[model samples]
Target chain A: MTLLLAVKALTQENRDFLAQYDIDVVTPDTVTDDQLSEVVISYAWDNTIGNKILSLPNTKLKWIQAQSAGVDYLPLPLLAKRGITVTNASGLKALPIAQTVLGYLLYFARGLNVYATRTHWEPFTDQYLISELPVLVFGTGRIGQQIAHHIKAFGGKVYGVNTSGRPVAGFDETFPITDYQAGLAKAQVVVDGLPGTKNTENFFDDHFFAQFNQLFLFINIGRGTTLNQSALLEAIDDSRVKYAALDVTTPEPLPHDHPLFERPQILLTQHTSWGENINAGRVGGLFRLFEKNVPSFMKDQTFIQNVVDLNKGY
Target chain B: MTLLLAVKALTQENRDFLAQYDIDVVTPDTVTDDQLSEVVISYAWDNTIGNKILSLPNTKLKWIQAQSAGVDYLPLPLLAKRGITVTNASGLKALPIAQTVLGYLLYFARGLNVYATRTHWEPFTDQYLISELPVLVFGTGRIGQQIAHHIKAFGGKVYGVNTSGRPVAGFDETFPITDYQAGLAKAQVVVDGLPGTKNTENFFDDHFFAQFNQLFLFINIGRGTTLNQSALLEAIDDSRVKYAALDVTTPEPLPHDHPLFERPQILLTQHTSWGENINAGRVGGLFRLFEKNVPSFMKDQTFIQNVVDLNKGY
Candidate 1:
């Protein structure tokens, strides 16, 4: 079978791993129209190259593997129509993203950010004990569950919110999205881990933020489109949201003049949550996950892990 | 029996609690020369008024309960010569300070401080996993042990340095100050939790910092005098120390013009590590420790907790 590798550059180890399979690997520059017709699988770095290959007429692509967890950029309807099985690197980003979430929580709890911006010695009285703060995480997927696990390890009570909220492990309580008002009211910190989808778009608007009675810290490590930026700014102004740490913003490389950059209460992290140590063996994690599922896909066009539902948009 | 209360102001609850005792509680303004002669016990907020009370001739002070953990400012020689029992609020600051240590650790591990200072979106590459970083903490006393406990809870390996190399409950490995080279070499993050003393003063000087072969972050939550400011700045300049987080600096409220203020690699917290949530009931933690020991001291001239050795100077 033939496969297309559209990542930046595959490590020699990854290349060697693919060499073991009886497959012809080709890159976008090298693949001809005839070669594209023979491509049975594609390992995509992003939707840009993936869409180009998909647009080729009479392509024989059977499966598409996304390097990133979020598949919002993918042409889901077209892929579903073409009967292409799509898998994503979901659990691979869990640990690093979870660590990032903890970093934001502890940043606010210890009041380090406030003191970092100060020029004089003034005691900050707004610190909270991480062990006592109640956290409400929006999504119970791999990233959200991992965030909850870390928070729970630190003695923070975690409440998970999902569509069905069918009691996920590592959460003290789980509430369905429709009934999360009580959870939202009690949470001292709210974490947005929801992926970008039709259902999740603008999920945290003014109406949603108005549900909070007490001042709360909001952290968004998920897709930025899932949150309403204007509403978040308003919440910060009204003191409904005490602070915000946004790793992902609506537009990446947010325009230099974006007002969020000027807000001291908001920390924009430039979507660096997935930047784990290069020496920590994380570079191979996604490839390993792909390798594990390859056998299942080869046997019967079935994915053993992280298969995205085209209609659900995750 | 008479007890001099030289704190700024007593909470109504504290005053009511003191009222239950047979001791005559007098504030600094209320206590006169005659009353000084009757002052057999004292709960001091700092050395300013406590030293004055002790200097008075024909004074009857026998025991001093310091509200702060660090008693370096206390006249140790006079207290030791006079045979006055000295107890301090050592363990009281442990939780808050430990939380602060975790704040610094997570801050660097997640690059929040770097992002906080940035005006644009640029990914920071120096992030590390807290669970994988080896931490070396100086002075395994109440504060150091508490810092180790929190680090251990987060799966970080903690190496503690003490005078005797005696095993501490929370540390994975314990080393004496005489043999800390190996620990220093392995440490990715070095935390100074040592108190100010003749032996520890300027202990982390040029030679001590030169032992680090790899890039490391240094955190000072301990007394500022224990660290050599010049050497710390030099280390940061040469890139031997990648980052420095100082809660206490030499001559703090470090003049705004100090060179350390200009370096982006350093984070001066203005000594806010002890800032805990006022609503978290920390106001009573130290007083509660004092109350638990008060009855025993009154009945038998025996101290129950945190009795400081004036000769050692912690």
Candidate 2:
């Protein structure tokens, strides 16, 4: 039987549903090198195993379903060259990721980040509500839209930034990337949800943060390379930025001795914003997308959603 | 002139507004014992000055505008006997308090409570979304309703517990305090927003925590006396309760070495949920309520809002 390597753990329901199709399933760890020729599809791509499967002499890998929204780490050029189709899990994680963005804002707003470390009870007077401050969200994509939605739910004003500066749902105002700085002075909370791309590299540098007329809170849940860490550190040091919550940093698994880890004002969540309720029977959005794509791919090499352009690498 | 003791700091706007009234304003620190007889109204009650003013041989204190909703700390009987009209600052703090309650849930849900203490990058899979959990709010008053509203905005279900269980505004389901256990098994997040009353004293005890069919998150932003500290500790020790956030505790300022302060699972916020946006010249709800009452108070011995019933002690 033709094989499908399910790189991630599958729920019983997924297994039962896939069983109805004419394909044999094998996990990354369980799939053998000899079976590579039979493996026509891969579910939830893994870097090392993906490269190995592609490198096999008689490999028949035709398509890959990526587990994350960003395919920046995937060998997109190589996949494009080999004519291998790639589909991503984009909107699936927007809800949890957006929820985490609000969580980060509250951590700084309610003074939980400071109070979390205390051993004694001391009332802090610096606490504020989300409604009292305005939030500026850069990149009004699925993730940014969800963030804006939750912020609005808290009675907060949301200013969204996108390529065209077109109005998006849940945002009070929208600005293009070139003009986002115009809204900075009025924003007390700034968030970056821009995807990883050549144009976005080092986008939030010193010049970007210097436009804020008042001290503001910063949160970044987007690609790490888009931000300049030194500039953020300087902003925090000068008290221009009160506190920052980062889910993603320049390097994954930031070095234990990294200065970011030493700063009391910066909180590192280690890119785990997307890790919510998936462990329970809630079966993630990725799997649901995979299930929908399975029948189409099996029949005519097409997908129902999230087909990524390998050349753009998103 | 009849004096009004502005115990708390008054904004310039508030001072200007009070100037238009007939009563002359004086702070507790600025007032003399001889002036006690002239002090007819008090804005924002203070424990120390309240006792002193009431004890004075020839004091003329008539009405007091309490800064907090709870009058448990005040000698209600004495105020009642002295014909003191008491008005409270209720509903004003619902937004911030509810926001803080959600912050506590996120602190645990996003694993910030665990990650805040870590120096290294580690991905925790135990994280869950607020939407996945069902929250049970023990009081469906202003604070409780707001909490239910925010939780519902996140797409979570809310079950409210009140005296009659006759259905509050924002709750998906309602249960009387006597039959709250009927819904406890379905609740993954249980909140205490009940007031401090003789019937509610030590309401959350060993039997209360034991009713949960599964591990659940606990949050108490209500009166401390309503929850039993030892019972909560035992719940944490047994792992029956996942984590807890406490804003109010048994003693206002718990001793530095209290066992509750030492638990990694228990988060204490030092009862500062009400301290939000008030500092930013938003002019607290208390001041607005005071302003509305000032005109009526000067015209006649009456209040426009929040007149507390001394016998009920709410």
Candidate 3:
């Protein structure tokens, strides 16, 4: 039996992440139908080919571990029919996403970008005190919670929204996904960390963007589909959202000709938030589980801690 | 009969902040000495005529308030000799400084700038996790303690150096400011937030920056004189320190010829971190001491909260 690590590309760190175990690794295109006895799949978010290839595999494909957290784009139907075990590198990316969101918030809240271009390096003006500013986090998952914690530490008021509406530890307020409008009204800086799912597709449309008053900074560390690009563009035109910090976009590697590329208010980051100290090493705990043939330190937990329920879709 | 507000150049917001009360505002350059008894006195850090004008008899300066936290540059001896009440806008700037320090740690500990310039938008490989990263924070004052809270929240191993070495609430490891060399060995990113005084000047010299095995980031939110610019530039050359975020620089409004301005690794901010909204509508708390003969919030205390110990040179 052979083990296949089917990823678009592997970094030295990614290889090191798998090296502890004796699994053989290959790209998705190289996996033969017969060699699926034990396959571990990995792909960047847009690796549609990897999804299709896994669906064509036999029962030997025991587990389909996604290289990313979002699985809506994965061929879920085929995996469900085959009863294949799927794990995602979800929580592993939480730290980076949280850091990125915090960075976006700091850049604005602390006004780093505003002062960066000035010849007079001291901010005599252009200061918006954080303690008075309001921040709304769209998702209360690991990333959202971490961001909320940092915001709270800064003396800013923090509000969060989650599917369950359960209280997050540090947020001043929390609401269910249903009270989105109320939450939006209370926060000037709206941050999106919600997972991309059917329930949240195009969640930030014209109506949502319009509800927000002007001069707010819109940040997306979550999947890009949550925002209606057209609506966001119009809002930018209308000066509703004064700035946009995008880490993930509806389409990866935004085309050079895209108008969004030229917008001064928008600061685009290639979806590389999760790459620092690349997360390949994070899966070492999983390898230790494989070696022991045991449930792991936490017992059958997802590669990242939180398990997203596929039935309702995260 | 006249009143004066001896404040820095008044912007619309500053004017609005003071206009709430009925005091007419005037600068040293605008006032005649004979009418001083009818006016309040305030001064920005760079008020060139502060010493010359305040020396006038019958300037009748009812009170002297400083727009700066550090009043050493002012003709303090002469003002004190005149029995003029002096106070500073210090606490008002803590939030912005604390916020900037937090950004420096999170961004550097997480390698944000590195990934931004990378060709592969995918993450770079890494072996160890951030849990292994060690961060040292200097100064345990209002801003420093706030930073420690954030560092610990993010799972960082935090060590701090303060004057007393007394255990701070959030720091896991602390050493007296004198014993920092041993602690510096463990710090990948050392944040300098100590106020400038005799003991603290040129604190980040060649010997200080040379301790780090890995290139790290340095954040300065305190006075710029505290960090020897010559030493930090040397660190950049030796690759001991990778980048720096300086909210204050020695001789602020850093000269155009300053080496820091030309270095991509250096982030020199205008000394404006403390003036944002936190100070707004709050300074009058001190103003009430005499303007209306109202007792201070800390009326019985020997010193106002955050009052600098001039002997200690803060």
| Candidate 1 interface RMS | 1.9
lDDT of 3 by residue, A1-314 (tens): 23655454555655665555545676656766555444543333344645544655353554555556677776666666665555555565676667777776666666665654454444545556566668888888777877777677666898998877789888898988887667777887888886788888999899888785684689888889999988988999899888888788867767667777667667666776664553445455334323332134124422443333556554
- Candidate 1 regions with alpha-carbon error over 4 angstroms: A2-8, B2-21
| Candidate 3 RMSD computed on C-alpha atoms after optimal superposition onto the true structure | 5.7
What is the TM-score of candidate 3? 0.79
Could you give candidate 1's per-residue lDDT for residues A148-267 as a string of tens digits?
877776667999999987999999999999998868767889999989998889999999878765555899998999899999998898888889999999798898889899889898
Q: List, residue by residue over B1-314, the lDDT tens digit for candidate 3.
A: 13655545555654454555544677656666555445544434344555545655556553455555566565555665665555555554555666677655555554544443343334433322345567788887667777777667667788889877888888888889889886787877778877667778888887877776655678887677788889888888777787788877878667777788777677666765554555534444334322332123123323344444445545
Q: What is the lDDT of candidate 2?
A: 0.84
- What stretches of model 3 exceed 4 Å from their correct place? A1-33, A37-58, A117-124, A162-170, A176-179, A276-280, A285-311, B1-32, B37-49, B57-65, B77-90, B109-133, B210-214, B282-309
Q: Give the Å error, residue A159, model 2.
A: 1.6
Interface RMSD of each: 1.9, 1.0, 4.3
Which model is ahead, 1 or 3, in terms of lDDT?
1
| Residue A235 CA displacement from its true place in model 2, Å | 3.0
In candidate 2, stretches whose alpha carbon ends up further than 4 angstroms from where it belongs are A1-3, A15-24, A29-34, A56-59, A210-215, A278-284, A295-299, B1-3, B11-21, B29-34, B56-59, B212-214, B278-284, B294-300
lDDT of 1 at B117: 77
Model 1 TM-score, all chains together: 0.94
DockQ for each numbered candidate: 0.60, 0.78, 0.33
* lDDT string, candidate 1, B1-314, tens digits: 45656464556777777667767678877777677667777776556667677778877888887877888878889999998988888988787788878888888888888898788767686677777688999988888988887777667799999888999899989998899886777788999988888988999999977866555689999899999989988889988888889988889767877887778888777777876666436657767777787778777888878899999987
Cα displacement (Å) at residue A302, model 1: 1.7
